[model samples]
Target: MSEQHSGRRRRPHYRALSPLREHLRESFWFAPLVACVGAVLLAGLTDLIDREIFAEATAEQTADTLLSFASAAKSVVSTVSSAMLTFIGVVFSISLVSLQMAAGQMSPRVLRLYVRSRLTKATFSTCLATFVFALLVQLGYDETTDPTRAVSVPIVSTVVALALVLLSLALFVLYVQATLRLLRVPHVIDRVTRESMQVLTAYRWLAPPPGQEAAERPEDPPDGPAPQGPVLLHEGRAGVLRDVNIRRLVRVARRHGTVLHLVPRIGDFIAPGTPTVLAAGGTAPRPRRIAFALNVGVDRTMHQDLSFGFRQLVDIAIRALSPAVNDPTTAVQAVDRIHQLLAVLAPLPVGELRHRDRDGAVRLVQSVPGWEATVDLAFTEIRICGAGQPQVTRRLTAALDDLLRITPQPRLPPLLTQRRLLERAVDAAVPDEHNRAFALAPDRQGIG
Candidate 1:
């Protein structure tokens, strides 16, 4: 029986693929899939070539062979085009496919713009590959059979492949143009970076201008009298990786973390050191010797803004304590409870949470809930992409800057330490007048 008659219809071809097979097929990024497809087509093509040139002995047989060859070619094209149109979505699979494509492991011929950024590029590259493959195959056939030919099948295949490839390339370019237009790359980068800059500000991360040393923080107020306001500190120079900056205002840093920003206010790189914009935590600028960094994106100064409000509430609560909550030592004692309350309400975003020791066992652990943090981190990622000119470094670097702002540091003993800081906060929060003390354990206040 002829192989066709015996009928083990060639292995279930790619086009006939079930959804799972289809997925496996497209999983390739650059497209070894194309080669695999091409190989199948090549096998089919070889079968056609044999039918045309050597499969038969008589003229009638040759005529039947030619007809079969035509049918085979049509089937190949139909199969390929169909497979190209189907898409499967499973985030992990998509990521895996993307990774493979990025590594340049797949075929370009199958790189469809509908897939991914890298895949889109691969598709464009594939168009070039198709044109070459078709032309080479046609030349090989012409050299072997030099038929002067008004209708040589090899020549026709070459022409059709070439034309299709050119068309595909054009489509690919059009898609790219549209995508670039939609994304408005330059604009989006700028908008997002600016947002990142603001985020850096919120963290009090400062990057001072080059050569201009940052003003130092004043010495801690002398230990004697009731000082007027909180000490102002000048933070140090800082820079953030462009990618970390968020387009959306969503991340929040607690305490003294710093985020940095790059300033291109002075044009070219040839001129050394553009000013680094620093975000600091103080209500207003403080003249000091120690370098302090400020976060820019946030509107509230830690000392001036957010803490002020929290402390105000603390003060109100303290005043409410009046005859009941009053203690002269309350100022030093009240802060931890208030801070714990604020910590509870922080609504912190998803972050690289850190844990550190406060005492030997009382470890300071940062908690960021999942879903809530993603929105802002994504925004930060988006913003970093848009940050412009010198574009700074990678988006992650800007993010690292942002991350640093939120990066929790260990609070060890004096430098008067976390304990003292909490105490001062409570002290500042105390009411103007301490009335007759009534009673309730200070530990119940959430300060402990």
Candidate 2:
């Protein structure tokens, strides 16, 4: 049976949305600005319609009653508008402080997580919308010198403004809860783990089923008598390679009748004039065309970089194990989560680095880290940093044991080597036989 037939049927692959759209979606300002505009319009419409209804009131009693409430409504809206402004300042200050604390205590990259948080966006939007609504309603109130021409108070708009105040209060409570959650170490670790898992899922390759002949992996075109000279594409600017338009690159290669070799992976940094790709074929695609297919950014993003997830978790673990922090339990938590992620990756064939065209011809050749690299990225640093900490060592040992049990035979050698290294570290760091035994034991929560 063919590899494709032996494995699960592939799902329909949809092209990712453009980078600009993704950025706007992840931005903190866009959604809140949208909410502010919507609130302004809604307040304006409500004021206009309510004012008209008051002007057209046929009953003298209703007109007099509404007129009596006009002054009070205006006063209420004015006060709420001032209060909402104060609230906005306070909320923004709190958010900034929370971000600072998170960056100082945890990984700075996690600040992006807080920035992209829906709860934070919703809270800010609600507060801003309330301020705008109250301000607009307050401005619409007109106390004319002539009684007959007096604008009837927009009772509906005022009431809605009051409701917004209440909603803002509720959102404040939620914001506090969310900030607390974000500050918690376990919550932060879990969030990073979930994000890393998502990246892993998106980038994982389907391996052929057991006993089925594996698919012939695509390799770079072999040197030939008429070998095309390698074309070196240089980077135009310095930044991290955040994403790559693989399908587009494949199309570009197929168009130029060439095999494009990408020099950098998703998380690599390339300075200007650095060799970025080596094109080998009849017609090399324009440098701009190749560059256009790559998305470079000031910092690494979770968009296509799987190692970034591990980098984040490892950062948290090492930070937790640091002398200033001295929180081995948190480190253990991070290792456990890393172990969970490794379990998911253990059986899969990682680092499938070839992109083929529609005609089954190799078009794009890119480098991807295999299982061993990923495992090393995930564990090696934590192991070295947390070597002296018994709790971290125990958790690391347990994690390796768990991985060794689930990982396929070909992937075992690395896990076994990691296990031995961990044991040696335990022996060296933990002198007491009892403590060493405890550290070597596969305890999920470490020694504790």
Candidate 3:
């Protein structure tokens, strides 16, 4: 009973925080909002310093000099205050337009790239901060009509505002450059591929050893017969299953001496009534506790969903292949990055990973994509959309053949299956025999 009470005390804080963290990460307003608040506080501090410390200047001559400096500073701060509001408006407008263009040209999923960009957030934050700081500094200026009288001049505040404006100007230029670069297909593909690779690198350890289960021993069942415990249903608003607190779930399972099986995979959508987990071989855990161990959100993320990367790449390729676009070259570029990701994933273990407690009981079972699913995800759509385009077809052929050569023997069948499908697609789509042959031939550069 004590153990049960202690287990109940373990709140699912990770589940709650993960989604919030992801939301903040993808929001454009949060950073700039923070910057504005910080600017206000900083301006107040500067004003305090100017009044308390700088107001004590010794001589009338010194006061006159300070008054002249304050007058010039007031003009500069006023100018910055008026200009920065317009500057932020124009800069952000360009940014939004650029994002819209990129989304239309590529995939909506790529919008996260813009949202998560440090440079982008930094640019916006700095500009907004500068604007707010300038306004505060201008308001802190002395209001006395008499020009000759010694008044409190917010000298420090003015200097800080000018520095912020300069910084904002520099960031604006870099933001423009980055936004333009982001519109290019190759750069977008590369960025997605790089993020996916990082996710893959982090995920690799959970994979089973080659041709073996990721468990304590072969006898340990990765997933046993379903437990008779009550099913845990999702109670939250509908969302894409983003991630899971597997360790926490395992702890819960271990405390109850049972196995917890996740019903929805990482990328699956879970509605309010959807089955989220099954507690087997022990007493059923509380539905709320189980639900709190899962992270759900508005869209899929790279956190634990490796296939999202492939999905994004395929979206880009097929969109480029659309008749309206008719840009096979861009499709080929997307395929190039897809092939690169596959090369990295090819030899790695691919299956569900089981987590065991210290006593070797299977506490958690995580469902992951197999090799075939991954290969099909990466190649199937591209092959279908790009079948008639010689550049795309040739590149697809080269990617499959290369994977066939480098991948482990067990992984060969999937690559072979994709290769055959590509061939069939090309055969069915390309009419001329010579053109078909050219499409079928493997060329890494896609006919270059």
Native RMSD of candidate 3 (Å):
5.1
Candidate 2 has a TM-score of 0.86
On the 0 to 100 scale, the lDDT of residue 104 in model 1 is 38
lDDT of 1 by residue, 179-260 (tens): 4432332222232233333432332222112332223211121235522333323243333211111211011122224222
Q: Which stretches of candidate 2 lie over 4 Å from their true place?
A: 1-15, 58-64, 145-147, 205-213, 218-236, 246-260, 278-282, 353-366, 432-434
lDDT of 3 by residue, 216-238 (tens): 32322236665466678998879
RMSD of each: 24.0, 4.1, 5.1
* Regions more than 4 Å wrong, model 1: 1-119, 142-156, 159-163, 179-183, 186-349, 352-448
* Consecutive 10-residue window with the lowest summed lDDT within model 1: 241-250
> lDDT order of candidates, best first?
3, 2, 1
Which candidate achieves the best lDDT against the true structure?
Answer: 3
Number of the top candidate by TM-score?
Answer: 3
Cα displacement (Å) at residue 209, model 2: 7.2
Q: Is candidate 1 or candidate 2 better by lDDT?
A: 2
